[model samples]
Structure formats: C-alpha cells, structure tokens
Target: MTSTENEAHRRDGADPGHRHLFHVPPADGGRYPESAYLAGNSLGLQPRATRTELLADLDAWSRLGVEGHLEAERPWLPYHGLLTAPAARLVGARPSETVVMNSLTVNLHLLMVSFYRPAGERTRIVIEDTAFPSDSYAVRSQARFHGLDPDTTVVRLRPRDGEENLRTEDVTAFLAAEGHTVALVLLGGVNYLTGELLDIPAITAAGRAAGAVVGWDLAHAAGNVPLSLHDWDVDFAAWCSYKYLNSGPGALAGVFVHERHHGDTGLPRFEGWWSTAADTRFEMTPVSRPPATVEAWQISNPPIFAMGPVRTSLELFDAVGMPALRDRSLRLTGYLERLLDEVTADRPLTVVTPRDPARRGCQLSVRIGTGNANELTKRLRHEHGVIADAREPDIVRFAPVPLYSTYHDCWRVADALAATVEATS
Candidate 1:
C-alpha cells in the first residue's frame, strides 16, 4: 500500500472486515489481482451475503413450491414488507411511506401519475438542465400525456454561464419566479453526471410555497449519503437498488410517498390487485380499495427472486447504518480528491464534481482539458488495472464506495491515472 493509503487507514480507523463484506471481482480473467473497482456510481459490488441469501431463497422455492409464498424462510407473500423498515431507514422515511417494488423509471411514472397533476394554466414541470436522460424522457412523456407540449412546458435550471454546478440560490430564485406556473418540480437528489447534491429541502420548501408538488429522483443519493426525506417534507421519491445499494444489476427499486398522501381516495393513481388491502387482495373485488400506505402504489406482486439481493444488501446496510457509512464516505471521497490533486499535478485535468462534502456524494467526475478522456480511461483500465467509467466527450467518473472500497484502492486509481496521462501525453 502507498504511504497515502496507509495514512488514510490510520487516520480514518477503517475496519479491516469492511472489505470482506463484498465480493470484489478479479481483474485480467483472474490472472492478476483485483483492480481498483471504482464504479459504484453505475453498479455496486455484490455483497458477499447475497449469494448465500439467494441460494437459501432458491432452496425454499425448490422445496416448498407455491407454499414458499407463506412457508419459506423469508416468506414470498409479504416479501416486500421485509425490506420496508430498513429501506425507509436508508432514505429517512417512515415505514408507512415506503415500498420496495418495480424498477426506477417505472416507479417514477407510477408516482407521477398521482403527483404530477398539471391543471389550468399551471401545466409545466421543472428539472435540471443536465438531468439523466431517462428522467428527462419520463418527464417529457408525462407532459405529453397531459396534453401539454414538452418544449415550452418543461422548464430547466441551468448553471450560470461559467459555473459547473447549479447554485441553491438560483434554484430557489427560479422556483420563486415560476414555481406557481410549475405543476411539478422534479430533480435528482444527487445529479448523475456532475455529482452535485442539490438542496432538496430548500427547493422542496420553495416549490411547496408556490403550490407545486415536488419529488426527488434519488438514483445516485440513496445509499451513498444520508437523507431525511421525511423531515425534509419531500412529497415523494424513487431510487434504484443496483447503484450504491449493491442489490445486483437491474434489481427491484424503491418508492417513497409521504404518509400525508396515504389513503386519500381523491389521489389519482393506477392500481391493480396488489395495490389494495392485503386481506381483500385475493378477494377478486372489482373495486380497488387501495391501502392507507405507500404499498397502495404497487400494481403487482413482489418478485421473490429479484428481491433476494435487495434483502441481502439492505440487511448489510441495516447492520452498518447510514451515519457511520456517511462518515466513511466523506473521508473516502476526500481521499480520492487528494489523490486526484497529485494525479493531475502539472496536467490539465479538472474535477467537475463539487469540492464540498455537503454538495456532493462519493463520485468524483474528472475532465481532461487537453486529451481524449475515453482513450485515457481505456489505458487506465488496460494498462494499470484502474476501473473508472468514461462519459461522452470528456468525463471520467470514479466512485469509491464506502462499503467495499479502501484507501488503497483510491491510491491505486490515482497512481494509474497519473501514469496513463504521462503515457498518453
């Protein structure tokens, strides 16, 4: 380990057991040791417990057949409930306000059905200028569904002419001026590309004061940082478990609807049998008696196999808890920043992610000012075994997840990046 890494370990008091909790894949077809796996912003490393938990679930399915729904180790019938308390704790929501089901965009559309009510002259939606493509598409489709043209109705808050990130004051100023005409304000809790953590509470309060429903797409924030969605009075939110949550690829996602919205018959939402009261769920009732909780948003039965990894990962998060995790995340990310300073020394690399811990998550988006970023990224991976993702044009993102990533991993990535720059230059 580098002296920097050893110093970090000594300073942070990192537990030796943390890395063992994850199954870090080997590099070079297992010929060499594992590379510095720093791409948790895209897909997290699998938890070691996931395999055992999944095997147990499969065994229950094999042994009990349909009886697994009620008799299995974790019970498939109320399976989604198994994740409720822990998932809620991750996002700082009440158990009654959260549900684990569906994929990320799917739940966004489902929540939008009830929350994005465009009416009269107030028929606009507000989002970030550089929102993740999927979120932009979903919002546009919702606007079109409501008979509004997306071009004029979809408002965006862009950074100032020379700024790399949006300022909180600017967001509130936009909301103060146009929040009245905005039917909904949807933003990423942590922006996907820039890694900026928007001021959700201030923005939520501003949007609500102007009488617009507000929601957050927490795809990049859920398990990477601490949240207080309940105290923040966020109207609703949704996030995928694959990123940071470490629940496998395309795993089931989570939804949060404030408890205040529960059981409101006037709320408009598409419902199926599973979205109703559990006792009457199997009654085959023609009328939808939606439950008095966020479960009412469910339209189908929980996927037992899909939730296997989610249960395993959430259990890990419950044991570690978000506060301790966030503390480690801050230090890890700060260490990455320090390493990047040394890597980019005498070079033209720039960090697009905010420097302040309060304004960003674990990911640091680095842009090369004078070279092909994608080519440099390829060299970093192929030559030095540093695995960071490159975005279009000129951005490479490295997410040193607190759960499994070590200070040694951060040092390795920086060392590789420095060498790659010199070779490419």
Candidate 2:
C-alpha cells in the first residue's frame, strides 16, 4: 500500500541500538581478557557446559566402577557410539559411515593402512605444496612402508606464480593428466595456512575418475564448514575435535569411511581389543571383525573423561545449527576485514584468504609484508592481549569461532592489529 520509495526506505529489523547476538564489547573500553582467544583453529575455547559433562562422567565412574560400561546415563560401553550420529551430521556423513575414536594422525596412519594399498605403477601419492607438515611426514612414511621412495612417489600440487592458494582445476587436472600413476589424493579440506577451502565434491569426483582414492584432513575445516562426505563419495577423512568443535586440547578425533568400504572384512587395519567384534570382544578372541560403522578403527578403549568435553561441544552445535552459525561467522569476519582496511588504509598488508565467502570459513590469514610476524604476535599478546597465531615467515592467522566469538571481538582484533602495525612500523 505504500510508495516504493517509502517501502524501500523502511528497514525490516532496524533498531538503531541493535547488537549482534554474540556481541559483548570490552567492558573497560579496553581489551577484555577473552579478546586474545583467537586460536580456535589450533584449539577451541572450553564451553561452560564442559565442566558439568565431565562431572557427570566422574560421578558415573565412581558409582558404577566396572559396571559403568553399561550403567551410566551415557553408558561407557556405547558412549563412543552416541557421538557417531552427531559427528556424522556435523561432517555431512551417514550415521553408519562415521565414528569418533582415535586422534587425528593416528587415524590418518590407520586409514592409510587400510586404504593406501598401492600396486604396480599406480603407487604415487598426490599432495598440496603447502600441506601441513605432519601430513607430509605421514604420507612419506606410508610410501616408505610400501617400498616406494617418497621423493619419487609423492606428487605435490602447486599454486600458480605469486599465488598463495590452490586452484581446484589445477588439482583435478593434475589428477587427470597423471591419473595413471596416482594411488591416493590426500589434501586438507581447507588449506591450513591460507584458509582456502577446496571444492570437495569436484575434487573427489576428479580423483575417483582418475582411479585414485581421495581422503581429506579436516583438522581446520571439520566443524568450521559444512561437509558432505557421504554425498560427495569421499573414500575417507579425518579431523581433530579440539579446534572448531571445541572439545578441549588433544581430544578424541573423528573419522569417516564410505559405506562401501565397511563390508570388506579382510581389509587391513592396525587392530586391538576395542576394534574386535563387540559380541565376542570380551571373549578376547584372536578374530577381529570391525564394527559396521567406522568405529572398527578404534585400537584401544576410549578415554571417557577426555570424551566428556567433546560431548558438550557437539551439544552446542545441536543447539545452534551450522547454517545459523556460519551466517554469523561470515558477517563477523567481514566486519573485521572492513575495519582492518579502515585502520590500515592501503598498508602493505594483503589478505591471502579468498575474498569469496564460499572459499573460507571463520579465518582471515593476513600477510604482513616482509617483516617479522612472530614478534608481532608476541607483542600483540603482551601489550594488547590480542591472541592470534603467526605462521612461519610472515602470515598471522586469526580465526573467530562463531559459537563463542562476537562482532566486538572481531572489531577488537582489527583495532589492535592497526595499532600494532603502526607502532611496529
């Protein structure tokens, strides 16, 4: 009923004093204690719910002792099972195709033992040039275990000149052109240094077309982005729960194996009592038939107390769906980037993270030109209390996790970064 101009002028949810849902600006009009907690890519902030969950487990342990395996609210016997469905939902996998068990690297080595079977000329491994160091080491060791030389067998995918991010085409093209020789395509779901998210669906299809197995290291991407491991037809993937999932330091990690891989009762694995068939496990039989889902990868009984915090973190995701969480993340990171530009004003710094939202999660990898980044990170901590991470030579990585981080936190990072840069210069 109103004129177009009038209708356009009226904002739908305008309240001049509106604040972002998570915004709690520094109270002292100075840096708050939590401002320096931008290391969620390395480790997440502990949720307030973690303590209660831990106490519940402790109480169960004390009350039931040996019977706690079947007695508690979350029985120790099936506690890891309870995590599978939720973790599967988090990573875009079927409940029957995922499990939370071993740590990240351990899962990688074990998965390789089962999936990285190289034969004849198809014994080469494809990896990114800037792949995480631990992954490089593991892949190399895997090749050596199979009588292949890593220097000759490992194929590194590289970005074009003057580029810090990898192109999906280059990755796929490498797979296609060199398809005949490639055995496994192992790369991070999100490149850890640049925070560039690869096109998983496309990459997986390409790798499969090339007759290679595709696996992802989701250490940085797992809870930060929406994944569809089952839909994409990935062979396997591994991720630590300590980062975006906020499951405390070095917590139980998750693994996903395609449903097709489960029934192969004869595939190799580094097995132990926990991985033996549950019905016959206590019998201590020499036979080990992995559980139908990915839990068959477990080599030892889970550390119940360590899993408590992870259980609490996954509950937070259930409360706040990934869609809404990612919505807030995009806005918060953009706000930080804009404020950085305002303060820096054409400074030498350049952001390596993709400008596209689809290509990044909650991280902004700022390339501080030609100077010492480590010292800058240290100064930010001691002087300003703005905790961000410094990558080797010159980049400082900042990740503001949506669950606990806020617009004001992003604002503070920008403000502090500008001050730090100007002072350092």
Candidate 3:
C-alpha cells in the first residue's frame, strides 16, 4: 500500500469508530470488500439493531393486534415517548421542549403555524438562497397561505459575490438591518448544498432581537453536529431522522419548541386528539386539554412502525453521545479535507465547503469545475466503489459519517477521484 493508504489504515487502527454496529454496503466495483459509504449526509446506513427492534415491534402488532397498543414490548400507545428524551438529549433540549412526530417539512409547517405570524409591516420570512428546495417551497407556500406575495414576502439570503459559504456576520447584519420586515427567520442549521454550519445561536439571537421568531430546519444538522437548541434560545426547530440520525428513509421527524412557549394558548396550533395531554387523550372530552409540552404540536397518533427505527437509532446515539461523535467527525472530515486538498491540487475541483472546522460539519461539498457532477459521481461509485451524492450542476457532497465511516473510507474517495478524474495540471 502507498504511504497515504497505509496512513489511513494506521489511523483506523488507532481510532476505529462504531462501524460494526451498522451495515456497510458491499462494493459494487473495486477490490475493496466494502463500499466507502460516505453518503451518510444523504441517507445513513441502517443500524444492525434497527432491524431487530423493528421486527420486535412488528411481532407485537402481529400477535396482539389492537392490544399491542397497551401490551407490546415497547407499548405502541406511548411508543413515541420513548424517543423524546433521547432526541431531546441529542439536540441539547429538555424532554418538554422536544417531540418526534411527522416528517421534517410537516413538522416545520406545524411549527410555523404557531410561530410564523406575519403582522403589520413585518411580513417577510428570511431563508438562505441555497436552502433545500423543500424549505424554500414550504416557506414560500407559508407566505402564500397568509395572502402575501411570496416573491416579496420571502427573502433569500446569499453568500457574497465571490464566496461559497455565507458568513455569520453577513446574516446577523442582514437581520440587524432588514429584520424588521421579517416575521420569521427560518434557516437550515447546516446548508445542504455547501455543507456549511451556520451560526445558529448568533443568528437566532439576532433574529429574536429584531422582533422576528427564529426557527431552524436542522435536517442536515441533527446527529451530524452538537446542538444546544434550547440553550440557543431558538423559537423552534425541526429535523429529519433519515440522514445522519441513521433512521430509514422518510422517517418521522423531531421538533423543538422552546420551553418558554410551552403553555402559550394564544399561540396558534392546529390541534387534534393526539395533541391533548397523554393522560386525558382517551378521556373523550368534548374539549382538548393540550399539555404545556412540545407534544402539544403533535396532530395524529404516531405510526408505531415508523417510530421504531427512529427509537432504535436514537438509542444508538444516546449510547454514543454527540460530543464524542462530533470530535470524531472533526478528525474524520479534516482527514478527508487534507486528502481532497492533495487530489484537487491537480484536478479541476475545488472544495466549496468552508475549510474551518468550526464553520462546517462532517460533510465537504466539492464544486466540480469541468464535468457533470452526476456523471462524475457515477464514475466514483460504479468504478471505485466510492458512494457520494451530487447536486445537479456541479456540487458533490461527501460526508464521512463519524459513527460507521472509517479513515480508509475517506482514503478510497481521494483514490477514486485521483484515478477517475485526470489531473488537469
């Protein structure tokens, strides 16, 4: 093996991660036995424990039927509760401030229903220009829902002319200046396209200072990095489980409503039977008594099966805390960045994700300079067994998930790119 390759193996030996706990896909090409599964930022590998736990939940359904709600091993009726504390801990929030419910965007909309009150001249919603299409659509639709022209009501923040990542100062400055026009400041905690970790606390503070309720779409942030949403004083936040959280695709999402907002009856929330307090849920009362907890945002009974994977995944995260994961992530991604720097030196590629560790997460997004990103990713995958994701035009994202990803996995990515894309210099 080359010195660099040997270095990767040496590092793996020294700092091996929890790869054995998850299923790594077999390589479709290359001599390596396992594919360098670096796409966890897109969809995390299924945990070994998830299948077993999920099956147990299914068995309860098969054997007990409706009785499973009360008698199942995990108990379906309050099954969602099992996830609340762990999910809350993962994001550094109190159990009362957090709850896992519907999908990510659905949770965002539900939070917006309570938080996105555009009154008087403050009718704008601020989001990043490269905000995930779903967030862009959701916010724009929210503007339309309020009888406002989305074009005028939704402001998309962009990086300065020559920059790839948005600066924290720029965002705070914008809020300081135009924040009066903004009713809500909803941004991705991590920019999906650039892999940039925004200044969540600073931005939230700025938005709130400007009289706008601040929320976050943490689909790319949760489990990928350490968060203190409650401590950050964020008004609300929502995250999907399918990505770094290692839950299955379209998994149920978690939402955080600050404890301060818990019992505000004046806050508009679309309620249902499940939104009522758990004790009074089955009392069949004519009026709903929603708890002061974030669970009050829940609309329907959770799908027991859907909650299983997330619960199983959260247990794993709880076992291996975010601080430890983030430490490993910084080391793992820093290693990948060094490799990319060497490879991209001679190739038509540029790392668009911020170089500073504090400015980004486990993901490093590369801007392809000469070829179609999809085609390049196909070559990287089918030819080298390096699985990474690509944005339509030029960006390709590689996330060396700290849990299952190895130093060798990162080595394979650099090696794949070196062989596939000829050196331009």
Question: Among these predicted structures, which one has the highest lDDT?
Answer: 3
Full ranking by lDDT: 3, 1, 2
Q: Write the number of the candidate with greater TM-score, choosing between 2 and 3.
A: 3
Candidate 1 lDDT over residue span 330-388, tens digit each: 88889889888777767778889999999999999998876577887777777777788
Judge candidate 3 against the unseen true structure and give its global Cα lDDT, from 0 to 1.
0.93
lDDT of 2 by residue, 1-425 (tens): 11122222232122111123222324322346445467788878777668877999999989999999998888998787778778888999998888888799999999999989899999999989899999999999999999999999998888999988898898888888998899999999998999999999999999999999999999999889888999999999999999888888889999999999886777887888888767878876667867776767778988889888877878778778788778777876776666666755656677889988898988889888856889978877777767788997898999877676655556667767777787767
Clashing pairs for predicted structure model 3, backbone only: none
Report RMSD (Å) for each prediction in the order shown: 1.9, 5.1, 1.3
How high a TM-score does candidate 3 get? Answer: 0.98
Worst 10 residues of 1 by lDDT: 8-17
Clash number for every model? 0, 1, 0
Which prediction has more favorable lDDT, 1 or 2? 1
Q: Compute the lDDT of residue 101 as modeled in candidate 1.
A: 94
Candidate 3 C-alpha error for residue 225, in Å: 0.7
- The Cα error of candidate 1 at residue 19, in Å, is 0.9
The per-residue C-alpha lDDT of model 3 at residue 259 equals 95
- Residue 330's lDDT within candidate 1 is 88
Native-to-model Cα distance after best TM-score fit, residue 85 in candidate 2, in Å: 0.8
